[model samples]
Target: MKSKKILVWFRNDLRLHDNEMLVEAIAKSDDILPVYIFDPRNFQLTPQYTYRSGVIRAKFLLDSIADLRKSFQRLGGNLLVLTGYPEEILPVLVERYDIAEVYHHREVAHEETKVSADVEDCLWKLRINLRHFIGHTLYNKEDLPFPIKDIPDGFAQFKKKTERDAIVKACFLTPEVIAFVAIEEWGDLPAVEEIVSAEAMIGEVHQELIGGEEEGLKHLNALLEEGSTIYQKSTVKGATGKSGFSSRLSAWLALGCLSPRMVYWLVKDAEETFGTNPHFSQILLGLLWRDYFRFMFKKHGQHFFNDYAMKPERLFSEDREKLLFEEWKNGTTGNEYVDNYMAELNTSGFIPHAARLLLSTYLIYVLKIDWIKGAAYFEEKSIDYAPANNWCNWAIVAGGGKNTGTIKSAFDLDKQFKLLNLVVYKQ
Candidate 1:
């Protein structure tokens, strides 16, 4: 009997450990091809000064793909790299290689879901099955008390209902050996310049973080140690306009380079070994917040893209907004703290969560800028950028996103400035 062939599409879920699609692909097929497609649409840039995926993220992605390819090579598999529309390239691969099935993770964000749908449609035309697994979230949507449509609008309600007797499944043990098909067309990874051009970089160069599962696991392990005081320090700290106080796991978590379940278990184990503190739940809180944003995106499709739907009155004039938006994006708004933080982000594609909230507060509330514009800029530059988290969180902060109906006025800029010892930018 001829061997069955499958293509395992690697998207945000990049790692091998606890990867449902990769595991299932191996189980059901005699031979599997690991594929990562660098879709052209992903490299898109905004008007003139903004990019979709900034250099820091672009560089990180290249490193990740390189690492993934190396891992597949070690396991005697080909991680095919392609540059085109996934829907177009996937069908060609199926027709050429005689692939029996395709396996991928489901992305709930609008654009990501559309891409997946397009690929599915193309695959269906050829009678090829494109199977999807849920890998991004800490908890499966199926296990939630309510369906996605009925998910609670208030995060507290959602968290209370879901975390009550929360049981995360054990990690999937990766197979020691992977059976790969005899293929000679192993594609090489591209350089960062090949994707996003020099012109697309919107700000000063940020430090390039090494990517891949190995680096991600290393980061996770470091945070798991008892002496690591990230939790304690992050709790009381507001936007000191800096990073390094928190788990520093956002980039890896956002990219699916590290599994949320793994982080949860490791931190929980640390609590069991070392004495527990209220601070420990801080990390978990962040993870839960991440999950909530994803769920919110799933429930409220295109609504996330709107501007301050909750408060129509608190808006900047078009001309005024344009000026403020540019200043904020360029990190020249004169809030020295905000500029410093934005400079750090623009330079290296990273900023701490507290700092992010402060900057977002300044941009949305202080400058009266559109939350969507700020979110869009983050989408462009952040190494840890996730659509659901980026936009939805901005909305919530701006008195418009998700379920914050009671918020009417501006955020407490004075309190934030005092906590972080920051001052408004002067002319």
Candidate 2:
């Protein structure tokens, strides 16, 4: 009998732990071929001419891919790194490797789904199956209280019902070993220079967060070690003095270096082992919000990306609008709090959740700039840029989504700064 072979297509879900697709492939296939494609489309510039995947984020992704490759090597397998469109490259790979099927995590955003569709079409022509798994969210979609269309638009409602009705599934255990198809060349991981232009690489790369499952697990453990006391205070001295506290696991979570289920369970265990803190519950709430955004994207389709949904009366001429946007992006807005946050984001590719909410609220309700443009800028720069979370959160801020009335007005910068007790840097 001919040996069965399956190709594991690594996308955002890069880690081995709690990976359903990887575990499934190993179970059903005689040999597995793991591949990560560096799609050129992802590395291009946004319409605003910002790096779609900026130097900091791109480098982090590369580091993640390299780390995953090392993991496969430890398992006596290899990850095939390729630079090209998956639709074109996958069919070729299927033919060469006699791959019986391709497996990957399903994505919800327009561009990502479009790519999946293209790959599915190409693979269909060759009579191959491209299986998709749901591994990104804390709660599995199948186990939700309501169908995707019926999910509550307001997060509080969604959270209330889902927390009552739904249960998070246990994580898939990591396989001890993987039998992989022998290949002549496992392609090289490209540097930031190769991925983006010199001008795109000019910004300060965030050195604090290194991408990889190993590093991500270490970070998770450290956060757990601090217990709920630090988390309860919910303020930390950051690179930018006195920023909001965070687990700082988003970059890993975004890249799939860390599993959402793994994080959820580990946190739950810690709560049980240590004493329960309201902040620990808040951490889980964050994950629930992540799920809500992803499912919202699936239900609403491209509506979140539509700018006309929240289009305001023209406040300035096109040129003036551009100038205002540039000032905001370059941290020259002259609002001390907003500029400080922007500078931190520009330098570190990160800012706390509260900081993001304040900045987005200021951009839309205060600056009177288009919220979609701000979202695009985030897509270009955020190291933790997950499409569903980033775009939908921006839409929510602009009051464009089903949960319009949920986000309170954040236009009063002085009041917010005082409430958070954040000190602004003076020039």
Candidate 3:
């Protein structure tokens, strides 16, 4: 019998622990080649000319890749970093390393799903197997009481059903040791200057906003220990300028550096020891909202790419509206709260819950801009950008989401470029 060589592709999920594909690869193979490809798609601009992933997220992603490499090295393996589409790169790797199988977490969003499918096709030509594990959601789709396509229309209903029927599995434990094969010339992780241009990220970055699984775990610990940050406050308090966010480990979670299960289990463990904190339920509830958005995208594929609701609408082709939309993107809309939020998001890629709602309402209702514009802007700038969460939040605000009710709010001009939710819009 021949020993198997598995190639583990690190996409959004970067951490060593709680990674299903990584665990499966280590268990099934004696030789593993871990690879992280920096896809140009993530760094490119949208149809609106805003970045798909802004400079802030690009920097954070760089940090995460660097940390992931160190993690592999710590486990006696090296991570091969490359720049290109996975469909192009993985085939070359399969040929170079004689890889028998490729392993990765599955992505459900249209664009990501297409990329994975393209890579699968590429690998299939060589008779190599592409194996995927579901790691993105809190509850595994197979475990749902209803099928994924049949997920409830409203988040509250989804929550009720999931709480009654689903279970969040325990986090995967890290392997004590890992097997490796010698592969020379391990690729270098790209620098921030390499991934994004300088002028694209012109504002002062927040000192506290760094990336990687180490930082993610640290942030998660802080959130569990203290309960009054950005994510913990009531949306009313946050919107009315009464409180700021503790932020609930979003950047890390967004990048797959942290696992929701780990967060859940830690909270459960605390309840076991220190008595229950209602804050746990609150934050855990937030995780369920993320689960809902993810499932919704799978339920309704490709509908969010347009203005949503599919009503008769004309393009925002007017030069005046275009100019004003740019201002909204740049945080110069003259509304103090909206400006502050957009400024932070533009500069830091970190927008709090209150800020997200205020900005969403301001952009759609007040500015009379389309919801897709707001969503696209977020898709570009958010460190935590996921198509489902980003678009669904905007859709709800626009009165087109599954069952998210109409948001009522009064709501900007910019430096000429700019970028959803009445609710928390948890990501």
Number of the predicted model whose TM-score against the real structure is largest: 2
Deviation in Å, model 1, residue 321 alpha carbon:
3.5
Q: Tens-digit lDDT track for model 3 on 214-278?
A: 98888777766664333344233436435533445767888889887887788777667656655
Estimate the TM-score of every prediction: 0.91, 0.93, 0.89
Q: Which candidate's lDDT is highest?
A: 2
lDDT of 2 by residue, 224-254 (tens): 8778655523342322246455776788999
- Clash tally, candidates in order: 7, 0, 12
Number of residue pairs clashing in candidate 2, backbone atoms closer than 3 angstroms, sequence gap of 3 or more or interchain: 0
Distance from true location, Cα of 259 in model 3, Å? 0.7
**Candidate with the larger lDDT of 1 and 3:** 1
Go through the candidates in order and give each one's C-alpha lDDT. Answer: 0.78, 0.83, 0.75
Ordered by TM-score, highest first, the candidates read 2, 1, 3
Candidate 3: stretches off by over 4 Å: 227-238, 304-317, 404-427
Error of 1 at 60 (Å): 1.0
